[model samples]
Target: MGFIKKLGYGLLAIVAAVALFVLLCAMNPNLTKGLSEILYGKDGNSGLIGSNTSEEVSAGSPGLSTPAEIGLPAADSGIDASSLVPYMPYNGTITTIPENVLGRNGYTPVTGTGEVLSEAQAKETEESIDKGSDGSNLEFDPEIYPYYAMLDSTCQALYKQIYANACDLVSSFAPCKIVNTDQVQYTFEAVFADHPELFYVQTAYTEKYTSDKKVVEIDMAYYTIANDLENARNSFDSAATAIEEGARQFPDDYSKEKYVHDTLIQTVVYDASAPMDQSAYSALVNGRSVCAGYARAYQYVMQKLGIPTYYCAGTSGEDHAWNIVKLGDGYYNVDVTWDDTDPSSYDYFNKTDGDYAGTHVRKSLSVYLPACNGTQYRNLESSAPVSDLEDESSSPSQPVSDAEPNHYDPYFDPYINNDPQKPLDYESEHPESSPTATNTSGNSNTTASPSNAAAQLAVYGLKESDAVTTLQDYYNDCKVQLVSCGMGDHCFYNIVPESLFKTIESEYGKQNYLGGYMNSALKTIGASNCNIVIQAERLGGGYYRIWHNVYVW
Candidate 1:
């Protein structure tokens, strides 16, 4: 009897303990996740970690953050969100129509009836199409419309029809030819890539085709229609005009490109749910967009500036968009979208193929675009400008001889071991010489001369005022920190006001600017063959912290 009583109490205690553990698991999600992993291994097979059971992971899961939370921009045009999802169900629809031939009364009717024609009528219509039935009179400059140029004659005719109809807000029309639906899709994409002004249209469309695979009609989708389109265009133009006017203040293409890039980063915010997020209008007017909108806006503005810039679509983890810009004699890739981050980095801006091989791999038609190798203007803003340099727009490949007095190789080749030319003012000798120290590489290394000598210092938890305001001061501070450390390789960190940070970040991207500081420190530590890496982060409340990692051999 005692044994039975003891067993009953033990059972009750076990039940109580199980209930308490369940309660704890329900209360603490991390504990629940740990328990799930223990039960189902780390692939999240228990559905607690990788499942989309919660709204937080609705966009696809395995991570605690959603697509927006992790800063994944919306897929570019032609790339639906399905492309972003892993193992997303694809519902392929096969449009089936009668195999009968399409007979049109007029030269490609503005509207389609999909009427089946008898043999006699079909033969007559084909004859008329072959004759002077005024099919599509389309023309595209290869330089201005590179995508359009890539299409075959049939696709080009369809592209022209789509472009004309979309510009006029003609929603539905018969295609110029009886091509397949896949061809129609390809042609529409070409039109979209060539014409950024047609910002009201979406990347998707509906088509009527026969079972024989002949597309008879197409209906273009639109984000805004009729009057709404005019309003959107006005807003877009206003914003673009403001950007263009601001960019005009800069004299060179590099400066103008940088200005436009910075302006977009400053104004636009990446929003996955932004309306018409694939259109340039969403970015320029609404100030909200994904990678597609950013790319289109950039293409539009750069085209207006008479620069050859094309929208590039590809996969960066998921579907993405960027730009390929013509600078100097060659082309370079610019991804303002990725650079538009919390810290606003130049990590992806104006890079070469070798530079973006890992992060951005072009796909589809974007892969056919020119390779980016514009060494002269890759990071021109970071290099010290030489006076009387020939205009790149007119003389893109003008040779610069090393014999020129003030000329330095605009192209930065890190492989070249440039001997350090110690500044005369390195040891404070000849302190009276112009107050600007000139290195043999022709880069000016000057001390801090902030407009205001008494700016409160903000970096490194320093209370004492350090009048570091200009880029010169920022450069000097980096060198000073490296020399003070007495280490051949060290990470120099500094924080300054947002304005100064912007200036520093721009120059820091320059190989020459970074090399100057590294060389100065190398000279001090008696080392050679150095490398430098820069990292800048935006700390809120109008402050930014920059780190310069210098390594010397």
Candidate 2:
């Protein structure tokens, strides 16, 4: 029994000690209940009463102050409440309302029974009505009303509604808000100062009103007008400069005509095609240009320089374009496209209409320049019908005699005509003879027979003279050939008949002894009516040993 009591007492003492420890832990704020559980061998897995694990604890005492609560700096703390206001769905409501109702009285009753109300209640009701009114009774001040009304209705309504939603209204006052209330007054003042034109009552409004409406309206109008005018002035100045530059670049007055001619030649690169246009002739911009571009650009620049120039488009071959420029007292056909060749050649720039028109048969100026009347120029080619031969006759080698016949020739004389069948009577009568025939009236008596006289005259006519002249001219012209042959020791010969030599000698002077030797040599050869061939040998002594041959005809 003694052993049992001792053991029982010992167990009770242990329990009491545990209870005291728990109470002590509970009484100390720093000693958590979890510490006692761990000491007593409990699982302690519940949150703050958990076993000694590596997990972090975040729960703090209820009375502890957080960093934010203690006024430590925080993000977005200074943001405006109005900015955080939620977007309200669109609803039709006049937002800007006057504090005083337009026609409502403060003494008005709440019902149709007309029960009289206390002044304070009446005033409170009036303020409530004003706050709820759709702002229809609002009156804008005269000074700011015009500028505000000038805004687009949509923008105006939006602005007013935004202001109303953002504004604070007193619940117990007569009028909800005055026209000159702080927000409305500041906005009205700002809008007026910025855009004074809005106050002037313009009918139509622009985007200028929505942004910096005042500044935009004031600056845009004047700036736009001034800018446009400045551009126009600059364009005119540039055109004038181009004209002056052109004149200076090509200082020669005759250059214009030369340009015209050369342009025409190049225009017809070949007979197979028509002339090139402005784009094709751009290569000549520095040197020259086609008639159309030249005339148009020229006229444009000249007009800037106060010179009267016209582009004339008329028909020539197919269709062509040119210009007619006004000089001092006359207007000449200034076909610059035609005159762009070598100036020294008669085909250079400054040719008359007759010179150009004569080259072709159907040389009409109808398609040359379309702008100007053909009658404007004095030398304008008559629009008379010309033959195709005349139109296609631009060949430089072609003769002018084949052109229009003489005005006096009534029968269209066949003798002077280019027609091969209608040969001259004189030419047909002496068919065997050359182109030249001597007049026999003076030398007719010298021969015994008429036939013999005719034969002699025909044989000794201008054709023979021409042949002799041609030979002499060739000799004179080729002095270098003669000298070279003599130095090289080549043979030379004279091959004229003795009779012809005698006639030549009689007409001129007596021949030297060498001439007699030549005659003797010809007799030895038994040849008459021959061509002379001269040969010379190049002997060592700066002299040529001479030889001659007589070739009989």
What C-alpha lDDT values do all the predictions have?
0.58, 0.30
> What are the per-residue Cα lDDT tens digits for candidate 2 across 314-416?
3333234444455433444554443332321222122234434422111111111212212212221111211122233332111112223213212112121
Instruction: Please give, for residues 1-553, the per-residue lDDT of candidate 1 as tens digits.
Output: 9999999999999999999999998899999877777765565544545443433223343423334433332333222233233211111111221122111000110122344445555445444432112226667777767777666666777777788777777766766666775566556667788778888877777765555546555666777444586677788889998888877765556667877887887788888778877788878989988888888899999888877889876555456678899876578899877777655555567788766764565555554567786554443332221211123223111111121222122221111111111011112223235222332234454233342112222223443243366777777887788777664455666766666765554443333454447556657866533444444433233444555555445
Report the Cα lDDT for residue 318, model 1: 58
Q: Any runs in candidate 1 off by more than 4 Å, and if so which?
A: 1-138, 380-553
Q: Each model's TM-score, in the order given?
A: 0.50, 0.19
True-vs-predicted CA distance for residue 498, candidate 1, Å: 27
Which structure among the candidates has the greatest lDDT? 1
**Strongest candidate by TM-score:** 1
Output the worst ten-in-a-row residue range by lDDT, candidate 2. 104-113
